[model samples]
Structures are given as C-alpha cells and as structure tokens.
Target: MDIRVVACDIFGTTVDWYTGVAAQVAALLPEVDPGEFAARWRGEYAPSMDRVRTGEREWAYLDTLHRESLDGLLAGRPVDEPTRDRLVRAWHTLPAWPDSVPGLTRISAAHTTAALSNGGFALLTNLVKKAGLPFDCVLSAELAQAYKPDAAVYHRAAALLDVEPSQILMVAAHKWDLDGARAAGLRTAFVHRPREKGPRQEADRPEDVTADLHATDFEDLAGQLGSR
Candidate 1:
C-alpha cells in the first residue's frame, strides 16, 4: 500500500494488555483470577468511552476511565487506594509484543510511524518510553476529545500529521478500529493479536475483517510493507 504515515493502535495492537494488566492485578489481589479480572476490566472500555462519546460525561482521559473501571470492577473487594492507583498505572507500562519494537523500528526507517491510540498523552508517552517503541509521534484520542470509532479521532490524526486520510494507513488489531479508519477515508491494515485479551480471545483474528493488508504480527507487517 502506498502511504505516507503508518499510524498504529497501541494497546492490543502493539502491547499485550492482557498479560501486563493481569500481572498487576495478580499482585494486588492474589486470590482473584488475574486474567479474568483483566478481561473484566477491559470489558468496561467501550462502555466507558461511550459515556464520553454520547456526551453523557465530560471528556476524560483513558487513565481516568481505567481507574473508574477498576473501582467498579473491584467494588466491595476492600482494596486500598494506593494499591488501586498502582494497578491503574499498570496500563501505562504494558510490555510490547515480541515483534513490536523491531517491526516498528524497521517500518519507521521507511515511513513515518506514530501511535494513534485511545490512550491519553501521558499514558502513551510512558508506554512508548517503557517499551522502547519507535514512534515518530504520539497521537491520542484525548487530543481530539473523542475516542476511536469516532470519525473525529481519525481525522484529527491525519490533520496533526499533515497528511490526507487517503495517504495515512491506520494499523490496528481491532476490526472496529480499521472500520472506523476506513469510514474516515484512510487506508487500513489489520494485525492479528489473538491473545490481546487472553488466550481465548478469538475476536482479533484476521478472518473476520477486510483491510488493505493483514498480518499475523508486527514482523509480518513490516515484511509485507517492504520495510527492512
């Protein structure tokens, strides 16, 4: 695909949120099933963003939403504030997938690569730094005061990068994200992240979606894009 910028989704696309958050949750509540708790916490993601999307709530960063979701999930569990805060901060330190850094490094040498994620500025910044992700810039939904699946967020990323939607390729593991980018006139790529939520997460596989490109992982993506 001919593209000027390659914008990637952060959480599930590049980092293993399930494993990362589950480890933190396990540390906080050893008795709980960490993987299940992580899944439950992530289940609140879209709904929480929907509150802001529909104007039922003010614009809140993903970090704030994460904390709120954590509280709701842990209701009546007797968790202290400090521990809860650390658990929420866990989102900021997700480890990149095995292929993420090398793939991004390869692709960035040939094309401008940036993170276009629902994560807020501080959160994405910390993630990139902690994971050593090679993004040319970090663009967040917070910048547009909107979340993904909203056309505004996609358009805003293109605007900030000074590129046309057609010239920008949106790469994501979630079909919904690619669908939103496609609707907004951007080229799309789907990366399979089968274990994003957990080992049984069947949703992120490539069979269900159509995009300009599809790959099993970031390394495959780099190869397909002809990036060294």
Candidate 2:
C-alpha cells in the first residue's frame, strides 16, 4: 500500500445521505413514505448524471440535477416551491457517519485526504463544513466537467493532487465507483455501509466487491490502512 493520498467518495461512503434526506422528507411530507421517497430520489442520481456524461445534456452541477430529480419525484405531492427547494438543499448538509470524522482525521494524519465526489464544489464544501469532515482538499466531478465512473473525473483528481493514480487510494462504498477508479489505475478500497440505501437495503456488500481493501466502515478502513 504505497498510497500518498486517500481520495474518498462523499455521499454514501463518508456521509449518510439516505438518513439525512429521508429525515428531511419525513419532516416536510409526513404523508409520503420518506424511505421510498428517498430511494426514488437517489435512484434518479445516476441516470441524471449519465445524461450529462453521455452528452445528451450539457454539463450541470449535481445540485441542479438533484433539484430536477426532486421536482419529478414530488410531482402531484402537496409540497410548495419554497419547501421543495429547502428539501433539495438538504443534500448540502448530510451528517457524517459515526466513525467518518474520526477515521478521516486519523487517515489524514498519515495521507493527504480529499473528497473525490460527483458533488459540486459548493455542495461538497457545505456538506464537509456541516459534517465536520477533515478533508485536506475537495475535488469534484464538476471540476472535471464529468461525473464519476468516467475516467476523466479520476484523472482530474490525480492531476490536481499532483500524484500518480497508483499512489492514490480511491475509497468508496459503491463497487461501480471502485471499479472505475481501478480502471483509471488507482488503488481501490470498498467500505460497506449496509443501510446506505435504507434500513433493509439490499445494497452491495463487501463480498460482492473486489478492491485492494474491504472494510466494514471508515474506522475499520483507517485501521486496515495503518492510520493511527
């Protein structure tokens, strides 16, 4: 493990987006099933980004895509425009998982820790500040004008950090993200978040993913990486 930088996926890997968004939805629309609403909203994430990635749509920040997806998901619902906007912005303040801050703090002591996410710079910065995540720097798909799983995003991070892809460890909970990073020649680590989608999530588990390292959470990941 000759990693100099630890590039982390922000959404499900470090922060609990599911819990954060679902809680906001439940607060604003008690009649709607918050869990289902959250899932549906998140399900739109990839396709919305894919539209831009494939050149079907021009480059749009993730915040724009999130708002668009929210509008579609809230159609026929009784939410007002202002309330909808607030709910959409909920993503900007997701809470870090219990071990996220500590783990990242420890890892940062040993390596340059950064956010390598699809989130826009503003959104990721806000989330990091609100969650108290200890990232040395923030890098986003928006910066590369491309989303993750695309080679451009990974390459951009390596370039910005002035490191070889092989010297950066891309840590994420999504196998597809790890696969993309690996394809781009970066080392990969999969951290399992069993309830990332919801309480009974049938999401990808560590056993289903192949990476340089697989761990139960950020704390476990820090330990495995020999971070003190």
Candidate 3:
C-alpha cells in the first residue's frame, strides 16, 4: 500500500482505558464492583455516540457524552458532583499500553503519525500529553462534528493531513473502526487488543477482522510496517 500518514485509534488501540477507569471507580465507589461498573459505563459509549451520529441530538464532545453516560450508569448510586467530575476526567488520564510509547515512537520516526479518534479534542490532547504518546498530529472526530463509522471523520482526517484516503493507513483495535476507514477509502490495519474490555471479555482478534495488516500490539504493528 502507498501509506504515508498513519492514523491511529486512541481508546482501546493506544491506551488502557479499562484499567484506568476501573481504578477510579474502585476508589470512588467502594460498594460497587469497579470492573462491572467500568464496563457498564463503556457500554453507554455507542448509544450515546449514535444519538449524535443519527442527528437525534446536536454535536457534543466526547467528554460531555461520557459525563452523561457516567450519570446514567451511576443512577441511584451515592456519587457526588466531585466524584462524577473525577470519573469523567479519568478518560483524560488513561495510561498507555506497555508497547504503545515505543511502538508509536518508532512509527512516528518513519511516518507522519496522527491520532484519529472519536474522542473530543481536549480529551485526545490530554490523553496524548499525559501518556506521552508519540504522535506528529492529533485529529479528533470533533473536527468533523462526527464520530467514527461516519465517513466524514475519516475524510476530515485525510483532508487535514493533505493526503489521499488511500495513502493514509488507519490503525485500530476495533473492526468497526477499520471497516469505517476502509469504506472511506483508507488502508486499514487491525491491531489486536485482547484485554481491552478486561480479562473476562474476549477482545477482537485478527481473524475477526479484515485489514491490510494485523498484529498483536503496537510494537508488532511497527515491525510489520517496517518502522525502525
């Protein structure tokens, strides 16, 4: 493929959101099962995004949507305003996966690495900065007022990068994301993240997806792309 820009997904692809959010939940809501609460909170992600995607609501930042989800998930719980705000902010402080920094550093050295995520701009900015993720640029779906699986997000990324969609390699851990990129005419790379949803839930494997490349993690992805 004629790849130049490497657009990466952030949440599950580059960072360990599950562990991060669960830790916060465990700290704040000692009575609740942290892991289950975290999973339930994430379960609201898609439906919330769909509200905007389908024009049921106006464009809102991922943080706002996350807050809404958190509120709903904690309904009837003894969560205070401060605790709610802290939980929402947890997304901004997610830690990078073990191989993320090294892999992204190598890839950025060889290609124009960029973050292409549905996360809001501030959320993405905070995440990359906090985790020290090595990226040449950050592109959020907020730029296009749309989320992933919406062609506008991918097209906006290509336009911002000043590259043809085919010349941009969209790397993600989710099949739906890669499928969206593929539909938008971008090359796709699927990076397997077996524990993204936690140990009990099975994550997307290479066999479950179709892409130009597949790897166990970002380090393997860098090697596959021949990024030294």
Cα RMSD to native, each candidate? 1.0, 1.0, 0.9
**Tens-digit lDDT track for model 3 on 1-228?**
989999999999999989999999899889988988888898899899999999999999998999999988878987799989999988899989999999999988889999999998888988999999989989999999999989999999999889999999999999989999999999999988899999877878888799999888889999999988
Angstrom error of the Cα, residue 121, model 1: value is: 0.4
Candidate 3 Cα misplacement greater than 4 A, ranges: none
Tens-digit lDDT string for candidate 1 (44-131): 9989999998999999989899999999988898889999999989999999999999999999999999999999998998899999
Report the alpha-carbon TM-score of model 1 versus the true structure.
0.97
The local distance difference test score of model 2 is: 0.92
| C-alpha lDDT values of all predictions | 0.91, 0.92, 0.92
Off by over 4 Å in 1: none
> Would you estimate the TM-scores of all the predictions?
0.97, 0.97, 0.98
lDDT of candidate 1 vs native? 0.91
Worst 10 residues of 2 by lDDT: 199-208
After aligning candidate 3 to the native by TM-score, how far in Å is the CA of 130 from where it should be?
Answer: 0.9
* lDDT, model 3, position 134: 86
